[model samples]
Target: MQVLHLSTSDISGGAAIAAYRLHQGLQHLGVTSQMLVGKKSSDDKTVFAPKSNFSKALGILKPTLDCLPLRFYPGCDITRLSLSLEWLPDRLAPKVAQLTPDILNLHWVCGGFLRIETLAKLNQPIVWTLHDMWAFTGGCHYNQDCDRYTSSCGNCPLLQSGNNWDLSHWVWQRKAKAWQNINLTLVTPSHWLAKCANSSSLFQDRRVEVIPNGLDTEQYKPMDKRLARELLNLPQDKQLILFGAIGATSDSRKGFHQLQLALKHLSQSGWQENTDVVVFGSSKPENSIDLGFRTHYLGYFHDDIALALVYSAANVMIVPSTQEAFGQTASESLACGTPVVCFDSTGLKDIVEHERNGYRAKCFSAEDLANGIAWVLQDGERWQHLSRRAREKVEQEFTLELQSYRYSKLYEEILHFGDREGIKSSN
Candidate 1:
């Protein structure tokens, strides 16, 4: 079987990493596979083809000037992406066609790379993984259930700041038209998301499958916490709280501000003197009453082993994100024997077992979050039990071997189904 996996980035965060792992797994199964991504990090091109300058330029310019009706709306660029649709396929088709894969497996189709129309021209079978709700919705990458995508999306819940054009309705209409024309299978990484897809009008009649994301357990196993702290030169006595992602602190979508407020609440309630926040990708705020000199800010860690150490050293890992397709950080933290604390919402709802492995704060409330933090730190024995369970959870479900095997099976089934349909066509 030949497969072409496409995504936004080559090897950055969870989605891209999963894409690469799936690519390697496909190769192991003796299938010819290739990965195409719009943007490659400085280190990524060493492995995959870096995007051409024209595409990169468009990636920059499209967002800047292509606001057809005005500047900046919820799904503005995404809805208007078809404007550049004609130019991209010609340049990308040869590279994608060169692989001539049996199936085109698309991951994260948003972010201004090959729009849905590009896939229409492909003769091969198409399998798209819904990493987020963007594919089903009119335009918003994440709908948060405003029901705009289901019917006609005129009054978008996520829209903000625009000109006279009420672009949401037009975008939704266009999306419905585009989706009706595409021939593909939809894969959701979580059952919750799959259910959401099935309920939505766009995917109501479409075939949808639930396949969970997999983690690399071998690299993320229980490292000695003390040794990890020692290697990193972190405090032995302080209760380390680790959190990270690509744009962890800066992204409003991450709810880092909420986490900060919760931390401040902890301080106000007299629980912050001993706590230290070890942020991986972004830094802690310099002038904040919630954090003091206790914060350890390690800006942009690329090494896997070092990241593992940070997770291992943490008493708890916090995913304070308001939205997550799948909380990869939570899984990674669990793999390192660190329990995760996240808000009770969306992708995070499935991550923690609510006091079994970790705690989920009542909601996005700062007080609730602080209380959850205090409860974990207060009882060392129970927290230790959770820590062990966290490791066990990853061993059973999130391991790389488990993930690769699952994808191998899924790929085989997709290929066989396509073959059977082709035979029927010939008949």
Candidate 2:
């Protein structure tokens, strides 16, 4: 059966990487799988640059055509919409209408290309992976603190305007009406996200599957610690604690500021000298000021080998996020035999087994975070055991090959059901 995978961006984010990995995984299983991306971002060009300018222009135009509705929602990238119907191009419409792939597996369709109505148009069956909470709610990616989705959402809780597009009505009710007719199934990367999806009005009655995101195990497996550290120029003696903050100073959602605060507390308490906080993106936070912890900045390592080295050299991986769909970095670190620590948030809870694989601190508190870090650092024997277990967990549950196998079987089931249902319903 032919399968078409869709996503907003084809970059290296969790969803993009997940889509690409699934593509590779399906290929391994000898399935005919292809990718359909809304916009070709920078990574797309860098990763798959065309030899000619004509091909480059077409890449640019595909996303640009999705922007015609700016007259209504100016500056909004329609190509990035959630199940967007408004931007579905005539070129794609025919292929979608004709090929009618046995299954269309959608990853992250937020931004604009997919409006809610697009799902209703699909005669083929659909399997949508919930990378975040945006698919269930009115239109927010990460609802930090709001349970309004279980019922009807209005009197906006998370939005700064406290209103949804000047509508007095509940937006989710409208979304529910548009989405209820589709022959679609929901898949979540983490069990926590599955629970959240089940509680939502859109998917409460639907069968929610919890499929953990997979990694390229062979590529991410443990590297030689000494050689990795030497290649990365990291200190061998200091306990290398790796942290990934997307925007070290700007993105509050990442909790970079909170991590800085926790590290500050560690320094004042005389623990900074023994640790190193290596960050992946952007410049180091100036707020880490009095924290005498030696910092190592790897800016950003795009290649898997370099990333594997960073993960292998680190003694432990810290993911102190305020909110996350699923900590991809945590799984990657685990695949590299490095334990991870994060807050006991919804997504993190799925991967961490208390003190087994890693530590999950009290919901987003700096002191609690610091204490968790100290515990992992001081308990060398326990950490080593957890490290081995961490690798085993990834090998067993989170590999690209395994992910492809699971999805291939799921697609076959959906296609068979869709064909049988189509025949029966016609009579």
Candidate 3:
């Protein structure tokens, strides 16, 4: 079977990385898989991009072009929320048709890479792997406590618009008109997201399956703590707590503010003297607020080895996100044999077992988050058990091999169903 995976970018963010890993895993399992991305950063030959200079330039400008409609919503806080009305020029359908794959797998295709109208033009069966809430909602990626998407999106909170005949309604109408008859299947990386998708009016009748993102356990496995710290030039005496994301501090959804509050609570509880903080994916801000501990801001890591070493060097990793489709950071930290502490909500609850491999604190409670951190670090013997279980859990459940096998089975079932329908039509 031939599968072509479409994404906005390769290896750029969590979604991109997850998509690329699945592509690689399929190839490893001897399936014919090719990746087509709007922005290609790696040197992989199978990955394709727009060949023309003008098309490449347009691809870079598509995000901005898609967001131009937001200017009408003067009251909107664009920085705090996301909006994508995918109405820009997208010539991907013709290119995708030329490849002539049996199935087209879509992942994170929002930034004007594929227009709503183009879905009708594609002839092949589609398997859309939703990386966020964008596929079901009108335009906002995260609904943020709004259930408008469950019925029909309008008067969007993200757009700060009160009118029912607003931009969100327009986008929703476009989707309802364009995508009503398309042959599509939905896949989500977490049960929480699948539940959300099933409840959404856009995909309420569609088939949705839950599949967690896969990782190369060999690359993310643990290293010697002392040696990793020595290599990273981290102090050997102090305990390190690691926190990071693409925009660690700026993204409201990441809940960095919650983490900061939890750290402060830990400090007040007498853990401050022995602990320090390490962050990646962000440089120290000019007017950095006191985190109540010494902070090391390692700007960004481009490779997995550097990231794996950083994960190895830390005593524990904290992912204090308010909502996540799948907590990739927590999985990576566990693969590195570092215990994780995260809220017992969203996709995180799938990865962290309360005091088993790691700790899952009460949802949105900083005090519980602080207590979780202390519980993981209080005793070396218990910490060793947590660390061992963390690594074993990834090897058993989150490996690329297991993920690829499950996807392969899903693909086969979809193709078989299509064949049976074709036979009935011929009769």
Candidate 4:
């Protein structure tokens, strides 16, 4: 069966990475899969982009143009939240038709890559994998404690607008109207996100499936810790703690502030002298406040080998996010045989077992986060057991082959249902 995966980019962000990995996984399993992205960073021939320079330029500017309607909400917070009304140019449907795939798989297409009207025009069956809350909500990706999306989104907390007729309501109305009759199936990478989708006003009636993101365990597997540290020039005697995300410091949802607090607690409890912190995905900010430990900012390593090395060099990996769709970093750390410490909340709970392979601190509790970190490092014998289990868990459950097989079954089922329906119609 031919499958076309649509994404905003091929390898730029976490969502793109997950989508690309799935595309690769499908190909590995002998499925014909091609990816169509707004921005193509890889040289993969199957990954297509707009050929014309003007269309490419428009693709880059689409997200900014789509947000122009937000100007109507005078009280809105100008944060990095998404407010996709999906009223942009509908150029993708024709391109999709030209490709003529049996199924269309959409992933993170909210950066003005596809329009709401275009979704209704697609002839093929659609499988939309939601990387965040954007697909169901009125378009603040995380929703951040806002339950308005569970019903009809209005008076959006992210928009800081209290009017029922605000921009969020307009977006919600557009989605409700345009997407009502589309042949679509929903997929979420985490059970937490699936639950959220099931409760959402838009997709509550749709079929929602839970599938965790897959990774290449061979690439992410553990390295010799001493050799990794030696290659990176890290001090041999110091204990290293790792923390990062796409926009580690700036993104409030990543809970870097909580990590800082946790590190401070660790410092007071005699970790100050020996422990050092390593951050990826961002450079050290200009005049940044001290994180209460020696800090190393190794800005964004795109190479998987380099990332695996960094993960290997650390004693433990901490992902103190407020919420995550799948917690890719936690999975990667585990695959690298490094114990992960995250809160017992959201998608993270799926990856981290309390005191099993890693530590799951109390939700939103910095003290508990610090305690978990300390607990992981307190005993070398326990750390070895945790590390061993962490790698084994990924090999058993999160490998690309396992993910591909599950998806293959899902795709077969969807196509079989469509074929049966066609037969019924012919009669």
| Candidate scoring better on TM-score of 2 and 3 | 3
> What does candidate 4 score on TM?
0.96
lDDT of 3 by residue, 1-427 (tens): 9999999998898899999999999999999999889999989998998878998898989888888889888898766557789998688888898887898899999888989888889888888899889988889888779999997889888877898889998988899899888888888888888889888888887878777888899899999999999988888998899998567667778888889899999998898888999988888889987787899888899888889999999999999998889899899999999999999988888898789989998988988999999999999999999999999989988999998898888788888877222111100
Q: Tens-digit lDDT track for model 2 on 1-427?
A: 8887777666656688777777777877899776666555554322222336774565456544543433344334343332222333323444466545678888987545565566777777788888888778755566668776776665444333355442212446667887776777777888778878878876777766677788888799999999999998888888887887665455567787678778888778877777887777546555654444778878877777788888999988888887777878889999999988888987877787788888888987988888888888888899889889999888888888877887787777777666222111100
Total residue pair clashes for candidate 4: 0
Residue 294 in candidate 2, Cα distance off native in Å: 1.9
Model 1: lDDT of residue 178 = 62
Candidate RMSDs in Å, in order, are: 4.7, 5.3, 3.2, 3.3
Model 1 gets an lDDT of: 0.70
lDDT of 1 by residue, 1-427 (tens): 7778887776766677767766765666676777877767635332345456876787656433434443445454444232222112334566778777777888864555665556666767677787777777656666654775676655654554343235566665566776575657777776667777777777777777666677667777778888998988889988987778466444567877888888778777766677788878865456743453267877777766777888999898888777777787898888888988888877777668789888898767877887877777779999989988998988887766666676666678777765322111100
Per-residue lDDT, model 2, residue 153, is: 61
lDDT, model 1, position 412: 80
Global CA lDDT computed for model 4: 0.87
Pairs that collide, model 3: none
